[model samples]
Target: MRNTPLIEAFKENEQDLIRFLIVRLKSAFAAQDLAQELYLRVCGLDESFAVRNGRAYLFRMASNLAIDHLRREARQAELRDELQTFFGDEAEVATPEEALISRNELERLERAMAELPPLSRRIFYLSRFEQKSQREIAALVGLSPTAVFKHLRRVIDYLAAVRDT
Candidate 1:
């Protein structure tokens, strides 16, 4: 019923929603694509939609979008692999191990970040990488300073876990 709350909730989860889709879809470029798709779906939502839990509905839309993406990727990869096999003689050489390693690490970070509960991950990224202060990020993302600090601690713990791997 409250458009203000709906908009606020949507904005708060937007980054993580995009991140989740992009990571699963394996292309940050697709982030915009998926976001647009989500908006298209959400725009059609109605009165009953307004009354139910907004976050769950939004995520259900996201989850369905993700499924479609995964199916498309599977089909594309299969066709690409087959095409590459037939064109093996013209195929590019493999990337260097270091390059591959760096790529893997980037993907790993994305995956790890994606694993985090959305709000925690958002605040953590904004603090560490975006260089936002706790107060600034809290104001922007609708969290308290204490919540931001807790998120930072959780991020540190998660990074330590990744390093241990």
Candidate 2:
């Protein structure tokens, strides 16, 4: 009934609440974050607010917060599906022949990459997959910036030739 005592109890039981939330939510990070949010929500309650059992009330609040998180995630997944459907061609499912062609193209690209010198292959991966800038690639590979540019250009040209064939 007393606000100060209730707030103290909430703080004292913080770990227990987080453990409960983790079990319900199945994510330690989310449980910790939501537990902090639950504390803030409880603290924001009116001082005159009364509950018969403060711990039970806190548990109920935590449960509601976890449920809300799950609901939000579900809604977001639904929205993603709807957007993909609306976008049509960009998200369209590929036909069997198209899939085969795409797979073959990827295999050809992989073979072309394997044909490059080891350093050139590493630089290409760092630039394309890891998305490092040319300057960063040069620093990592201990190459001059111009040399890195040349290596990348060579790789591109080689891939273009492979695609043409």
Instruction: Name the top lDDT candidate.
Output: 2
Expressed as tens digits, the lDDT of each residue in 84-134 for candidate 1 is 897785966557986798788888878898898988888887876555679
| Candidate 1 global TM-score | 0.42
Model 2 residue 18 distance off true place after TM-score fit, in angstroms: 0.6
Please provide TM-scores, in order, for all candidate models, with all chains considered together.
Answer: 0.42, 0.50
Number of clashes found in candidate 2: 0
List candidate 2 stretches off by more than 4 Å: 1-3, 88-165
How far is 85's C-alpha from truth in model 2 (Å)?
Answer: 2.6
Instruction: Give per-candidate clash totals.
Output: 0, 0
Model 1 C-alpha lDDT versus the unseen true structure: 0.76
